[model samples]
Target: MLRRLALTAVVSLATLSAVTPAATAATGPVPLPLPLPVLQDDARARLTITVSGSEDSAAEGTFELRCAPAGGSHPVAERACDRLDELAGEDEDPFAPVPEDALCTLQFGGPATARITGTWEGRHIDTVFSRTNGCEISRWNNLIPVLPNVR
Candidate 1:
């Protein structure tokens, strides 16, 4: 009787392992969407920035961007991909490895047409980033300081 029970348990475990992949594959990886940054071009627009990663090397995930003051003191702006009606549970969070508060968080989103924009606060943002293999992927620093009609 004990032997029979052990065999049953082993079978159950094996069955579970075998089925899990199929279940996931049956659904397949959800089509991850990208939310681009907000950019306005006008005399009063104040600020504009652009980012890209849509060259095919991007992973599936969200992109949050920050528009803090270049220097002095200022608040930060945040952007998130995926909406309530979109695929959240199935997301892989391409931005996983990087720190949320990382200075480069300023640049994020899809591999293509992933633009972001926000008004500056004061002066001196520690870093600026350019998208890489993925939306959340970033590199380099572009410290921008405020000046008179700097543009």
Candidate 2:
């Protein structure tokens, strides 16, 4: 009986070990895909994101993020300036000069906070103010006038 109990314990331990990691990976430290460029067109548009546990992160590349109108509706990335322009007062040129290589940074342990003072708009705007934790612009979000060739 003891031996059978021991075997059952070992099997349970192995199964738990295998299953635990998959659950963790689902919410593990997701590295930066690229620098997400979020549009900052409002003074009260800054936000903070928090992360838990210990993880390392690095910048991937330049990412352009767009924000929704005042009501926080949220914008979609890569849709097209033709639609975004109407709301932004003017259309952003898809062919604008964005840093081809901007990296995102991990802010803190437990809860990271990402702040911005600009408008982020690509095809779709990332309205979920994530604690992406890297803002290169101060006071006003870095402005890369939407050009007409990047698209």
Tens-digit lDDT track of model 1 for 1-151 = 6566667766776776677777778897544324323333222112333433434433212333333212212112211211211212444422134465555434444334333244322222233344443323432211111111111
Assess candidate 2 and give its lDDT: 0.34
lDDT of each: 0.33, 0.34
The clash count of every prediction, one per candidate, is 11, 45
Residue 140 error for model 2, in Å?
Answer: 96
